[model samples]
Target chain A: MRRAGVLALVVTTLAVAAALDTPAASAAASRLAWLVPVALGAVTLGTRPGALVALLAVSFRAPDILAGVERDGLTAVTFDAAGDAVVLLAAAVMTGSLAAAARLQRRRYEALGAVQRVLAIEAPLERTLRRVIACLDWRLGCAALTLTLRDGDAVATASAGCSALAASGNRDPVTREVLRSGRIVYLADAGGQPRPRRVLGAPLTAAGVTIGALVAERTGELSPPERETLVMLAAHVGLGLENARLAAMNRRAASELDTKIAAATHRLAEADRAKSAIVALASHELRTPLAALLGFSELLATLDFARDEVRRLAGIVRRETARLARLVDDVLDLSRIERGLPVPLGPRRVAVAAALEAAVEIFAGVDADGTGRRFAIECEAALPRVVADPDALDRIVKNLIANAVKYSPPGSPVGITARAVEGAVEVTVADAGRGIAPEARARVFEPYYRAPDVVRGVPGTGLGLAVVKALVEAHGGTITLDSAPGAGTRVTFRLPIAREASSAAPVD
Target chain B: MLAALGALAGAAAVLGGHGLLPPRAAALIAVAAMNAAFIATALAWAGAPGAGAVAAGLVLAASGAAAGHPAGAIAYLALPAWLASLARGGRLVGLGLGARPPAPALLAGAALGVGLIAHLALTVSRTRGYGFALGPPSVVLSSLAYDVGVNVPCAECFLRGALFNRAQRRWSLHGAMALAVALGLARYLADPLLPHASEVLAGAVFYVALLGMGNCWLFWRWGSLVPGTLSGILLFEGYRLLVVS
Candidate 1:
C-alpha cells in the first residue's frame, strides 16, 4: 500500500509537471515546473528511481528545445535546455542520496530485529545462525552473509545468498582477519565490476573468547550508522550463538544423565533378583545334607544292627558331616562376596605342580570308578612357585577340575596342565563334554547361575566357580573361560611368580 | 601489447580524422590489424575455437567497411558465429565467450547505455544534434548492424574477455579492470569516425571512459560477454543519432 501511494504521488507529480510545462503556459526557458516530479521521486523512492524520473522529465523538454533552436541559433537554446536537465538531475541525486541514507538506517534496524527474533527462539545453533544470516541477506541487503562458529576444533559455517558468492564467505581473508584481530575488518570493493562492494567482518566474541566471525558482503558502501548497527548486531549474535551452544551442551548432558540413571536402576533390579535366587538355591542345597544327617540318626536310633553294619553306618555319618561342612563354607563365602567384602587370603610362595597334583588326586576316584570320565594331569618340570595363597591355589585347581568332570562326556578325558610361563604360573583344565553355550558362558561364574540345558541333571550348587574366582582374584591371579555348545570347555587361571621370594628355576 | 595497440589505433584515428592521413585507408588497416591481432592472440593463448568464428565476423566487417557496405553481409554473420559459439559445449564459457550476463547486470547495462546517451544528448546537442529521426532507418540500422555483428564481439571477447581475465589473475582485480577500461578508452578515441573537434573529443573522452569502465564491469561481474555486447549495440545505436555530418 505504501508503494502504491508512492507510485500514485510520482504519477500525479509527473502529470502536473507536464501540464505546467505546456506551450500554452510559457516559453520553454521560463519553465521550471519539471523539477517537481524530480524532487518528489528523489524524496520518495531514492537515487536510481529518482534518476529515471529525472530522465523522463528531461525528455519532456526535448521538442521545445528543438523548436527553440530553429528560431534562435541552435547553440544557445540547446545549452539552456541541457543546463536545465542537469539542474533537475542534480536536485534528484542530492535528495535521493539523503533519502537513501534514511532508508538504509531503517533497513538496518529491521535486520537487527529479525536477527534478534531468530536468536530468541529455541532452535539448534546452526539453524539460528542460518536464519540470522538470511535476515542480513534480505533486510540488511547484503550480497552474501556467512556466520562461522568454532565447534571444538572444527568450524561450523552457515551461509546465506548466492552459493557462488557466499559459499566461500567463511574462508574469506576478511573473515580470517576479523577473527584474528578480534576487530572489525572492512574490505572496500576495488573493481568497477558489480561484486560485493564492501566486505565487513566482526569477530563473534563470547564471554571474552573469540569464537569465530560474522561476515557480510554488500554491493554498496555503508553509512556510519549502518556500520555501527552491524557491530552491535555482531555482538548480539555472538552471545546468542554462545548461549545456543551452552543450551545444546546442557541438552546432551541431560540426555547422558538419563541414560546412566536408567542403567543404574537396571543394575539394582538385577541385584535384587539375584538375592532372591540365592535364598531359594541355598535352602534347596542345604536340604540334601540335612536330610541325609536326619535319616542316618533315625537309623541308629530306631534299628538294632550287627557290629560290622554299625561301623559302616558310623563311617557314612562322618563323610556326610564333612560334605555338609564344605557346603556351609561355600555358602558363607558367597554371602561375604555379596556384601562386597574382600576375600581373606594367606598368600605364600606355593609350588604350582604340587598344588595341581594334590587337587587332581581328589578327582582320581571318579576316574577309578570306571566312569568313562578320566583325568590326564600334565605338570611342567621345575615349575616356578607363584606368590599365591596355597589354599586359594588348591581351591582354584579343584574347582576347575570339578567343572571339567561335570561337563565331560562319559568317554571323554579331562586334561589338566600347569606350567611356568612368562613370569607367571599358568594352569588350564579342559573337558570334551556338551560344553557350555556361548550365551551362558558369561554368567557361569555368577552365583547360583548355570547353563539350563547342559546342567539338566548335574549335581552340586553353582557356587563352585564363583567362590574360586573370588579367591583367585584375592590371591592376585586371573581366570578365563573359553567354551562353545559343541566344542568343549577350557578354563585357565594364571598367578604371578614370586620373583622377590624365589626364582623361575625348579624348587623340587 | 594491448596498451600499445590501443595507443596506435587512437593515434591513427586522430591523424586520419584531422586529414593528416587518409581516413579510409587508416580505418581499413586498423580494423584488419586489430582483428588479426585478436585472432592470433586467442589462438596463441588457448586456441579458442570461438575465436575463429568471431574473427570471421571481424574480417567481414573490415572488408564491408572498405567496400562502403558495412551493413550488408557482415551484419548477418553474427548468426552463424553465435550458433557456432553455442555448439562449442561450454569450453568457451571460461574464456568469456558464453552468454549469461545475469538479470541485474543486464539491467545495469541498459541503464548504462541510456545514461551515456542522455549525457551525450545533453553535452553535444549544440554542435551535433541528435540525428535519430533525421537519418534514414537504413543508416541507423547499418551502424547498429556493424556494432552487433563485428565490433562488439571482437572487442569484448579480445579486450575485456581475454585481456581483463588474464590481468585479473596476475594483478589485483581492480587494477585489471582499470587497465581494460584504459585500453577501451584509447580504442574509442582512436576511431577515425570519432568527431575531429576539441569540444567533441572532450565529451568523447568523458563518455568513452564511462562506456569502457561500464563494459569492463559487466564482463567482470558476470564473466560473460553478452551484457557488454548488448550495451555496445545500444551505444552505437545511440551514436547513429549524432548529426556530426
Candidate 2:
C-alpha cells in the first residue's frame, strides 16, 4: 500500500510536468519529477511486489493524460502541460520495464524451490517430468506446458500438464527452434488474441547433450524477463529428472543379487540330501563282503593243513582276513557310536599280572617285523585282581600297541608297565615316536579325522582311539593320554578291583 | 467313584514326574483330593450328553464344586484349556517324550504326587512328612542280625516305594507280578531260623544280587534310554535317602 501511494504521486507529478510544451515552462515540475520516480523506483528496485506497484501507478497516470485531452480542447491546455505529457509517458515505460524484470526474477526463485521439493519427494524420471509439467501450469500461469524428450533417435512426448498442447503432438516453430538451437525462444502476445497470447520455449540440456524441450504458454503478454525465468526453470527440471533415472537402475541391480542368492541356497540343500543317501547305501553294501571274508578265514584255520608251510600260509590268511573284518567293523561301529548307541560290556575275574604279560606277547610279535621298534613290559606281581571284560581289554591294549608300532621309527623302544594303586590295576603304554601335537590331540579321538602333517596315505581309519576309550569306559575304567610333538606318547588306563568276588586284603 | 479318583491321582503323579501335565491341571490335582470331586462329577455326567456333553458338563460341575465358586470354576477350566493349547502347539509335542498316550497313565500318577509335594515344599520348606518311600527294607518289616559281624541291611531300609499298574503292556503283567512277589518274599526271608540259616541264604543273596547287577548291565547295553534311565535311579535313591537316612 505504501509503494502504491509513492508510485501514484510520482506518476501525477511527471505527467503534469510533461503536459507543458517547453522545457522552460515545465522545468520546475521536471526537476521535482526526477526525485519522485527515483525514490519510488529505489524502494522496489529488486522486489517484484514493490516494482509492480510502481508500474501500475505509472500506467494509471497515462490514462488520465489521455482522458484530459479528450474531455477538453487541446487549445485549453498550456504548452508546458503537453510537453509534460510526453515526458510522463516515457517515465511510465521505464517503470513498467523495471516491474516486469522484478516479477520474472521472483518467479525463477520460486520455480527453483518448487523443483527441488518435487525431486526430493519423487525419485523416478517419469514422475519428476509429470510434476515439472504440473508446476509450470500452477506457478508460471501457463495454460499449457508440454515436455518432449529424446529417447534414442525419436522425440516423443514424456508428460504434459495441458490437454491442448498434448493433443497437437507439440510440433511447432517455437519448439523446433529451441530443440535445434538448444536455446530459449519466445513468441509474444500472438498479435493481441489473448487466447494464444505468448509461448516460451527452452531446450532441456543435460551432460552437454540436448535431451529435451520444455514449452510454456501465457494467456497475457510476457515481457523479456518473464521469458528468461521460464527457460531457466526448464533446465533445472531436466537435471532433477536425470538423477531419478540412475537411482531406478541401481534398485534393479540389487533385486538381481537377491535372486542369485536364493538360487544358490536351493542348490546347497539338494547336495546335502544326495550326500546323506550315498553314505547310507555304501555302508549297507559293505556288510555282505565282510561276512564272507570272516566265514572263509574261520574255515581255513580249522582245516589242520598237513605241512608246516601250509599251516603258516593259513595263519597269514587268517591275519589278513581279520584286518578286513576290522575295517568293516570300524565303519559300522563309528556310525553306531555317533548315533549314540551303547557299546556292549563284559566283566571277568582277570589276574592283573597275566593281562600285562598277554599284551606284551601280542605286541612282541608285531615289533619283530622290519619296523624294529623294541618292546618293554613292566609288571608288579602284587597288582590287584581287576573285574573287566578280557576281550575289551585286549582290543584296548592291541590298538595302543599297534598305533605305537605303526607311528614310531625303527629302534624306538615301546614301553608297557602295570601297577596297583587306589584299589585298582593301572596299566601304562608309552611309545617313543613322533608324538601328537597339542593342537591335534583334541581331535585325535574324533572318528575318521587325521592331522594335517600326518602321512596322507596312512592305512589307519583314525577310529582306534575312539573305540578304545569307549570300551574301557564301559568296564568302569578311565583312560588318559599324555603327548607332545617329537616327545612320543604315553597312555594309561585303570580298572577297578572286583569288590564282591575278592575278600582277601590288598597285597600291598 | 473313589477308585476312579485314585486312578486319576495316580495318573496326575506320573505326569508330574515327567513334567508332562499342564501347569493348571497339575495345580488342581495338587489341591488336597481335588481330583476326587471331578471323578464324582464325571460319573454323574456320563451317558448324559444332552445335559451339555459329558466332558464339558463334568468340567463345569467339578470346577465349581472343587473351587467352591463360579469365578474360580471359570479360571480353573479356562486356564488349563488355554495353557494346554499353547503347549500342545509346540514345546509339549516337540520336546516332551511323555506326551504320547502309552506313557500318560504312568506320568499322571507321578505328576500328582511330585507336584503336591513340590507345592508344599515351597510353602513349608522344612516338612517332608507326606513323602513316600519304596524298596524292600524300607517297605518291609524284618528282624535279622549277622553272626559273621558283616553289615546286614534291614529289608525296610531298602524299601523306597511300590508301583502298581493294571495295564503294563499285554503279557508283561505276569512277569511284573512275579517280580513283585519275589521282592516281597525276600523281605520275609531275611530273618534267620538259626545262625547257619544266615550262611545258607548265600545262594539266595547271589540270585537277588542279579537285580542290581542286571540294571547296571542294561545301562551299558543301551546307549541312551529315551527319557533317561538316570531319572528313575535318582527317584529311587531320593526315596531311599528320605526314609532310611
Q: How many backbone clashes are present in model 1?
A: 2
Per DockQ, the best of the predicted structures is: 1
Question: Candidate 1 — which residues are off by over 4 angstroms?
Answer: A1-10, A22-44, A51-144, A158-171, A190-196, A219-237, A298-311, A331-342, A348-373, A380-387, A407-413, A446-462, A496-508, B1-245
- Pull out the clashing pairs in model 1: B10-B190, B131-B241
Q: Which regions of candidate 2 are displaced past 4 Å?
A: A1-96, A123-125, A152-196, A265-508, B1-245
lDDT of 1 by residue, B88-144 (tens): 665455456555557987888888888778656664564345444457766666656
Give a tens-digit lDDT track for model 2, residues A1-508: 6667566756754664365334354445543454355335544443332333333333333333333444453654534445554454455456655665666677788889987787767444566667767766678776667776776687666444443433456446667787888888766432222023357788888897777888876553354566667777778776766665556666778788888888888766754553454355445435444565566566666766558756666565566566566656666666777889977655777776676678777567645466656678888866667877776777778788877877777778989898888978888889888899898888777655556577343345567788878777777889888999999999898888877555343331
In model 2 chain A, where is the ten-residue run with the lowest total lDDT? A188-197
